[model samples]
Target: MTGLRVLITNITLAGRTGTEIVVRDLALGLARAGDRPMVYAPRSGPIADALRRAGIPVVNDIAAVPATPDVIHGHHVIQTAVALARYPQVPAVFVCHDREAWHDTPPRLPGVRAWATVSDSFRTRVAADTGLAPEAVQLVLNGVDTDRFQPGPALPPRPRRALAFAKNQGHLDGIRTACARRDISLDVVGAAVGRIVDAPEALLPAYDLVFASALTAIESLACLRAVVVCDGRGLAGMADLPTYEALRHGNFGVGTFTGPVTAGAVGAAIDRYDPVMAVAVGQRLRAEAGLTAWTDRWRAVYAGILASPAGPEDSEARNLALAVHLQTWDPAVAPSSWTAERASLIRTLARLGSGLEPLDPGVSVAATDGDRLALTGFHTPEAWGVWSAQPTCSLRFRPATAFGPGRIRLRLAPFLPAGSPDARLTVTLNGQPLGELSFPGADGAEPRDVWFAVDALDGVTDAWLGFHSTPCRSPVSLGLSADGRRLGFSLIEVAIEPD
Candidate 1:
């Protein structure tokens, strides 16, 4: 696999998710293994920040990738489709990291050379669903950076501190009960805790036992912590050799055919937890699921994909692939009903007015040249709309389409000015006041959706959707000197929905 130019695409590079970690590790590992791995993502967050800090190249545009990469590997279906469409001559592979990646079947694209799943259970199911030969979809377990998540010190015999580093809300009560029964102090973390902790690798070593599953479980095992695989679904007890082997094939038995997480099962796992046992499990995982081992498997897969013949081109297959991408966002884009007539007049429109052509005829976008901000490095297809301070350059959109009872949803990039009061956006429908939306003063790229009901739009064939914000200082004036634009809001997406 020497000199292989591998282009890896993921939907987002936000940290706190296992997918981000896998992609980050894969890039770094591949680089270390003497291969060129470039990452393409729509958005940047913790993982992207880390990658940049480590000198790993991350690109936002697929066009920016070399004209002839040796392989295209993607984590999400839409990304795979984009790659296949843009690089029709390249060999591609889609990694099924979650149930949804292949739930509707792999993108029916001609360029996709193979599929890889994080677990064997998914490998088999996806192969069956996509009708690919069993060997075409292989199992590539998620790996932890053993060097970073290496074992802490030996745990005390009577460990009282426990942590639940998972996001499964369904298993929280059981985890609490089990920890209480075992007289251990439990600190719940992850998305279930209302926030995603940014430093999972640093946090795991502080606990004696952890309730997690999937990559978290593997990472905890590497940190020499006794892991109870209760990922919101059910309990798959600590990784004693038997349980480790059984759980390994099923994502630690979290969402894969495991019974519900029960207090008894969790409590029993807690009672059975031993420092010596935890050490043994961690040692085993460090060798088997380490970063080196995982990347080696991917390296071989890339080599195999490149060595194979290109998939035969089929026009129907390309359309099917596009349908898979569209269906992920809306089932209304079903292959049977995607006749262009019933399709949402507006689908995946990036902004009110941008250089890109309109996705629907019913929508009209017009803006002053200065108001259009090119958010070219992100997931959006069009440059985003920056609220212009100038009166005639504000963000406004008019949809010339009849509608039933429904509402319009605007997805804005979460942006809050530093040291400023909360900003309120007054939305209007057809020259009448709909309501106001507020955004807290914070800074992040997470999407915030604001919906305004348009009950008055029932019989109307056209209406104006307007966003007005209180006049504010420009980013540069406010001391964010790098950004000179006096923008009110960055509009990422807007769509109408039936009430």
Candidate 2:
């Protein structure tokens, strides 16, 4: 096994997302076990740089690979399709990490001798999508590098600091409100908040509790943090001894998020946190979900596939399936040129186009009607209005009448602390600067109309209006309260009036 060559394929090595991290850990772990592991990703970034430094070869071009591998461990369908096509005789095992993501769709190809999934939910999904028998789809639960994510110092009797470690920040508002009520400081670190950390293991030890799902939850548990299995979808409550096995079976993911995500619900879940129980659960996870044991499972899968490789008679079927997959999902480009970010941008643009509506000149557009308009970077709507969650927010509109010089008025309340300076809000229309507004600290929570005069409306068919405000501050940082969200302003309404 010391000279066993393994080629791992993934969509992108640009970020520390779930799949990307998994590929990194698996490659490193296999190499540590004396196997030669190399990675092939179309898009490369910091992760690829790190792998190269570790003596593992990461290639963007298939022809650059020095030698063929004994087994191909494929992740995303696009890269897997490319690898399988290039190495038609190679035995490969495809692993599905997500149930709904398009890239996680299992490919039907001749070189693919085995199908696997990271969770029970995705096991069923991959089986259904690939038309494989449920028994045929192997369940390979996600694992954490226990050596890297070892437990830190002992936790306090009560949690003083908590973390929401998820890429999807859907549960943040509720988690923030709940943590505030408990007098606990909350911090967020994920792509959703633009706070991605390459080494989360270094950060997880400082928090007494962590709110995450799937692989993140397992990593947190291994770090001896009280884990709450929740994400953008909903809440699954705290992971305790009573519910540990059930949640573990579900991969501590969406399958366990059966409860609604609200301040009250999240607060109730927070109340169940037990530092002692956290230690126990973490010990169990470290034993059961350690990377060494997980790598052994993968090695076994590779050996099994190598022993009984699928026949090459399904080439026509495989080609037809690949063609249908490409046409139905992305027909304009080849798999080698595709990236996850590009796909997301296209989907977002399509949604924005479909959501646009005719904007009346004199009528005010209320924040409550956000669903009817194209919007981004705003939180869930409240009775009064919607709060801009990020430093920048944007909206799209299409005026009903001919465009001309006009003033765009917005009724927004700045989140200024008692002694802080005035908050500056800069406006832009169709990428052109419109105007800037300065709101004094005394503006308070009362909404005031701020107008931005525009010279012209060039893109009258679909005008994109943007707001870039000064950096946001949290109530906890201001020592006013316990809320942890970086507050900007509450946008109540927007109206356009021709000059």
Candidate 3:
């Protein structure tokens, strides 16, 4: 993987935004991994100097036209993220650091093919706006350099690290209250950090108890302090460094960083953790989640893009012409409407050129006998939990309408109690699951694709789909139309088939 080149775009090196941290960590990690990781950002300040000082080369120019060095990436560079689309022939990936970025404007340029986001929550948001599947959006959590961090100095705080944060967050306030009812000084090292607001800069580093909002936590670790975090939040791979290290060494004057923040939880952390012996934990994480390790992750992405199909805008236009020559094409997925009829699909496919393949034959279907295809039937109580409404079938029926076998020349209708991947149904035939042509979903409040399939089933009498139901989730409704106003099956030239 050595010598693989990657150009990170749209970052200003000097500021302390998460974008900077990501670039710094990425460069540092890449260096450790023996990579040629180049960062492109506005040339200025300590950030640029710092990157250079750290041996990371900086390419400063906002409008710099990027050539194929291997891969071209724009991160934290909104609006321009989709600029990758301009290089339609090039396999480019856009990185989004902000969650609500797409709300105001499209995050992608019709040119870009792939996207990456920092959090799953944020990834989902982007996928919805881009009309891309969630998988099209990759989840690469921010990482940390465990090597540059260690358990914080034992500057005799009025209390210990774990105890301090527990107390500072007022975990003891409950004890203080219960004391009126008979309890005192209880420690809950792990507590929930719901919505976060920035704390005073000067006060953050020296705060008595340190419950991290991920960003600050990893930074605190670099400064040698133990960090307490919510169960799920933290640096992607290396987040567990603090707790694991403290427990491993038995010497940091600390213990595990965990939650369910309770007296028992705190006591357990303290009981088996050895801060001194914990050094191994940090060392191991450095090997596993460190910069070098993550650089490898980026390398694969670069390689995949380099090997992918793409063209310039002019070339894309030519491709459309070629596709039209073939009379088959797919335009950028447009909302289903009379304006976007079967004729529109044919034109869109022309834009796609002959290089792109149709979704899948198995998932494509049209209603032949009627508007509804009783693909399969099932029921759930009004209340259900995280259950997959996704059903698979092995049956096939003649198309009331069709483009080609399994080709959705026209969208009969599409509905989801939820939507998209969450749309609940993905087509599988004769036990084979279709890729890019699949569906899996569950019930939720908002509109989503909870049932769908990339292709239509060809043959079989019986079929089964994976399903789940729980108390916390909802009244399950299946989608049946393109506008998604009705609950029924997509009337394609088929019926539910089984594997």
Candidate 4:
């Protein structure tokens, strides 16, 4: 498969949890496969920075660059739903992490060129809702990162504490009662229970029986405990004999993954929930599945997209395919529920690449009109390679967005870079460097919710969030999380903030 200029859009990488984990894993997988993965986030926080660190290209805006994508992959419903407003071409795939997320889709949606679901069951349900053929929807499958979630010692030694944090919190009641009968403890964590059964995930080890009923279960397993998972049945046979079989073969038993769930099926699962044996079983399954193999599959997916024809809603004439909302540029246009919206905006901007550049071509700014930066180049993997050599390019932006509390955002090029970088920020209130502030990158794209505290803006009309070059090459790399990388060397914003 040839290289593809793919566009990856999503809600936010603001937190260190569920959807974010999947995003990181996917980005990492794409990156490792020799494809350029540009991450366009609407909002960002610590999570966004983490993604940059892992060598993924990140940007804030979409209109900055002129490069068109060979394919577009939306990580979530929001991503696909929103992209319809921007792109004329149909997407290669809309990755639905949760079927329930479709309920939030905008009406009369333009169907993706392809559909992806994390679970086969969810895929069937989505097909019914979309009125599309069941076979049309593909099961991309949400895989567990075995490296992050290896099985630990077997039962007796492994605790029986269970969790159903995000997607699986609904199964706590039945699982708890079953644990009681089995003489094992069950501890549930996450925001679903609210004030009633609130428990920090940090205290998960207090219980012996670990029952994972949702995405949170993966985190529990990551803790290296004996766990049973309910996939289909009420118990989904999460603690069935297979878990025991697995434990007997492995060193320390972890637990088992259930087939699915059934009604009123707690007592039986608890009786059979074997942590030690389950761990072994999960390991074997993972080995058979082979994460490296999974990564290879993702590589194929990327390569296939790169070599495919222009997607729907896309014109075959030009090399440039990816486009975005250039007029309405603000965090307000994003999902208000997330904090990484702004980061996403800026990160996408930095990733804007030249259109249809050769496999080994390069890119440099040909012209700039006010806030609109005109890029002159083709959209190809070679452009990506050249950009990756330097990852980022920052300009002292004109304070067109008002020197207020908002970010000076723009459109970025492609999204294929290695990692985010630590930056050295120096705020200037009237051309004076107010000491120095250093911002750090993270493991993957953990949106940086950086609050750039500029020194007294009292009576000051303009301010400059000083940005000096560092390692991160993201177009949205406001040298400082609280600053900007554009503008004339002259009139600087007298912006003094504790970056």
Candidate 5:
């Protein structure tokens, strides 16, 4: 299938994470199979650079994508939305690489001819969550480049070196302690290690053992290293034949590991390492998870989608627009509520202007649904912060009762290092300035309140809080810190007093 244009979209291709690595390798595979694959992302990083060097086309903006492609493959919700909106005619495929809850109910977009997940478990879960038939969702297991990760002359075992490579730092200390106690020299890699290596997989032959999960675990096994599946959650023990089978169905136990990741537990897993088993694991992975076989599966998938009927150009457009709007629009303040007709969505967007605004004074429109406010931005359970270079987040609230003239105050703290002068922020409410905010020039401090007074709130019931802050000086260059996160501030709470 020469000149089959395959457009792969992702949030970004700047890091060496599992998803990024997969996207890069898939593009390479497509190119090798006589297909033209162009990667579309909003941001670029080392991975993007590497793909370009491999002769794959990479565009940072969807608008810049040349002509219409045969198929659009998106890796995230935002990417799917962009594909649906920008290329309604193209058949689309959504790839579920992570186990995020948000992905379960993906953007109800049009032209999504099929869906693919990295594991069988997700294939079932995603099919149920997205309302697709079980057969509609395909299991596209992650693959490794055997040419680069193949077994080599095993390094000497005198020093007992184990490479700890992971983006998640949750169980890092426990793994480190375990390696220290066992007299194993642990060479940690990945972004969480405060540095990012270009091709860490190629270095796997230098180690006797590797602590990783998902693609990394598979790669290590392919590289003839004793593998342990551990990440932020905990440990999934050593990967023997039984565990390997179990891990395969769970994407190498990416989010399925349920055990505690203690030093002793990790040490025990390390103790089970046998050089003979490592060699066998490598051979098995080479035969099963090699790039050629993986690429053939993708090729078949692409061919199937292309051969199918032309998808409805307007299919799921309304639902997708609604999902995208609710993430940022404050219905209490917008022209229309959630139940408003689709005709009203266009009018509401014009009234809201994609900016947070406080509701106007009118008949007391007490919200019966909920009184809590919803915040929009990237946040993990462990910490909350803006994870964008130029971070701007909007807070939507629905008061239980009609709001009278009152004051709105916000409590927020910077998630920056001590003495970061660049943490200054400008606050706004519906485009109205609420003055600048400055946090304590230190980390680990309680958030302070900043108040905004309104002239009239006679019947105001819904409000929005907007924040803007400085962008990261070097988003792509933040290596070893392994976090390409562009953070602004961590919001604590919001208080509205009816006067």
Candidate 6:
């Protein structure tokens, strides 16, 4: 397979997300294995920069590729379609990473010689979706760069420090509570927590145990850290010698997460941690899940496809598949030429189709109000409130009665970790600045009644309330608590009252 030109396509190279990381490792590994590998992504960012620094060419435009590739290693469906359409003669092996994601749907194209999935779950999904034989979908489990994630210092008798490494921050409160009960210091790093570690290989060594799923769990095991197969979906318990093969077959992903995430569940997972057993698991992973071996598997797939290529589909069939792929197009990832008007129209149509209704006036609504009140930039609601996960959060609703001068009251609590500054919020109504509200650092978690006068509501039937707060900081960074979520403030309740 040496000297084969491989064109790898992905949706974005913006961040170290799951698929992006896979593409990054695959390209680097293929290049090191003597293949001429180039990457094509719709958008470029840090991951793209890293690939370029490693001497692998990355292009956003399909036309920019210097020459046609011998084989196409396609990822997301949209970008894969672009590559396949551009290089009609090239045979492609499409890899499906997610079972539920629209973009991960296997392409029904004739030029696609093969299909690969990262787990047994995804393999089953791809096979079912494409109506192919189960054996036809290859299972290509994700691999870690074992050299980069070498075993760290010996673990203590018990885990003194732990990490919750997942992009989906589901049921984190339970994990935090579990870690607190055991007196184990916990930190979090993931997109949901506003912390994206570019080199998790460097970060995994510091923790004796890691609460993660999929690739992160594998990487942590390679670092000799006891791993609990858990993520936003749920808890999957500890990955020890006995369960490693089963978990590995499922890619240590959602399929393994059979139990709900709770303090008891997480605590039980922690109880299963064994330092000696953890090192044994790491040794096994290093032997079997190395990037080099993984790359070789892919090379074999490409070679096999090249040896017996599938015939190209008829023009009508190809056009129908392309049309189906276009249905999954997201304006957020689309080119700058995607007009705002078009995006707005799509959203409007979606909302209308969804049958969304406005919140009732004079009724105080809480964070758990769900779809009754439109909320954005807020995390999943807890029993008491919801944390604003971003720098700004907003609420949209239609006034039940005719508009008049009024005041909006918000019961909120600032997320002031120890030694951090107080949170200041700039309020906005219908896109116009209303006023500001400041909460002292001492008022942590204690809901305070903050009211702001809004005269602009006089003529508005629909109202948009925005809260722009200071930058949110994670408690792990401040050494205040084990919670890794970057929080600005918590919204407990909101109401609008006539002046």
State residue 441's C-alpha deviation in candidate 2, in Å: 66
TM-score of each prediction: 0.63, 0.67, 0.46, 0.50, 0.63, 0.66
Per-residue lDDT for 1-499 in model 3, tens only?
Answer: 5765566665466555556666777877767776666667654466667778987777675345334445666675432442343334445577766543321222434445567765544444466556666567776655565554434444332323332222124234322243223222223333232322322232333432344444455444444433434222101112244445332221111111212233333333333334433334434544545555566677677767666666545766645644442232224444322234555457645733221222233333322211112222211111221111123212322232222223222222333445433333344332344423222453333323323343543332222221222122334445433321223334333232222
- lDDT per residue, candidate 5, 1-499, as tens digits? 6678899888778776677888888898888888888989888988888888988888898888876788887787677777777776778888887544442335555577788888754554465456775567788888888887868576454338888876757668779999899899888887776867787666888888888888888888888788888875456778887667667767775444534456767877888887777677678878988888998888888889889887454556756664654563344644442324354446546645222233332111122211233343323313332232225555555444556467776666666655444445777654456778655445555667777775553443334455666433433211111232334565655566667
lDDT of 6: 0.77
* Predictions: Cα RMSD each: 20.7, 16.5, 17.9, 23.9, 18.5, 16.9
Model 5 lDDT at residue 387: 30
Off by over 4 Å in 1: 101-105, 253-257, 311-331, 335-499
Task: Give the candidates in order of lDDT, highest first.
Answer: 2, 6, 5, 1, 4, 3
Candidate 5 total steric clashes? 5
lDDT tens per residue, model 4, 16-93: 555666667666666666666666777766656776888676665665323666566776555654555556553456
User: Candidate 5: which stretches are off by over 4 Å?
Assistant: 101-105, 133-135, 155-159, 311-499
Alpha carbon RMSD to native, model 6: 16.9
Tens-digit lDDT string for candidate 6 (207-267): 9889998888888898988998887655668989998887897788765554456677789
- Residue 484 miss distance in model 5 (angstroms): 38
lDDT (CA) per prediction? 0.65, 0.77, 0.41, 0.43, 0.67, 0.77
Clashes of each: 2, 0, 92, 122, 5, 0
Residues 260-357 of candidate 1 have per-residue lDDT tens digits of 35576577678887888889878988888888888899888888888887656677877776666566546554442233323322532443233233
What candidate 4 gets wrong by more than 4 Å, as runs, is 1-5, 64-69, 81-91, 103-111, 129-131, 157-186, 193-208, 218-225, 230-265, 288-290, 305-499
Native-structure RMSD, model 3: 17.9
